[model samples]
Target: MFDIKSFFKREVEKKLIDVDDYIFMPERVEMELEGGLLNCVLNSDGRVDIFYSKEGVTEVSSASRKHPFTSFETELNHGVYDDVIDDLIKEVSKIIDGSSKYFRRNKVLPSTAALPSKPPTDL
Candidate 1:
């Protein structure tokens, strides 16, 4: 007799494992761009933090003490992690590349007021 319940359970477990490996396990990823370093960090609560820092600076101090040039936070879902991350990178890249002046004009910083009023749903 086929065990449907067991099969479904295994499938779900495998999906979770894949999500963990693809998203959570990395913890932090960095990319160096023309303007500075772009940092992405995954928090346990499903929030991803993307920030920018100047080149050659100590990541720890910049991340801890100074306000990031720009910061984006979004919840990562199993199937949408890749899109979410890519979108964030594009947004930050625009800012760093000087193609977008919206952030610069407003001087948005990492603060309660600067946070997105509602979680983004476009992903």
Candidate 2:
């Protein structure tokens, strides 16, 4: 199992405004942190998001037809999902070693608030 709690700490609320700069993966997408639901914005790579929400996380208010890839896959494995919200998120999610459970049981890719620059090399 992945330490989702810490994962959130490291990525979800890292104060990273322009996540695109931190991650340079081809599929990484930018992210927007909201109440609970991490909405995935449409991009050339993919239009979806991957996240683990707290119990009271936000929900999708507007009704829709197809469940985005994130929603669909999330239904299967609650731990992780994928969407193309921005360039950064898309890129981060693709890396197998990006995180502890990157592609296995706990692989996930979520965005967070922007932070001051600390040099990509530092990260």
- Evaluated with TM-score, which candidate comes out highest? 1
- Once fitted onto the true fold, the runs of candidate 1 whose alpha carbons sit more than 4 angstroms away are 1-26, 53-86, 89-123
The best candidate by lDDT is 1
Q: Where does model 2 exceed 4 Å of error?
A: 1-35, 55-123
> Backbone collision count in every prediction?
0, 28
TM-score list, all predictions: 0.31, 0.15
Single out the weakest 10-residue window by summed lDDT for candidate 2. Answer: 58-67
RMSD of each: 18.1, 25.1
Candidate 2 accuracy as lDDT = 0.38
Reference-based lDDT, each prediction: 0.49, 0.38
**TM-score between candidate 2 and the true structure:** 0.15
Give me the displacement of residue 85 in model 1, in angstroms: 5.3
lDDT of model 2, residue 121: 81
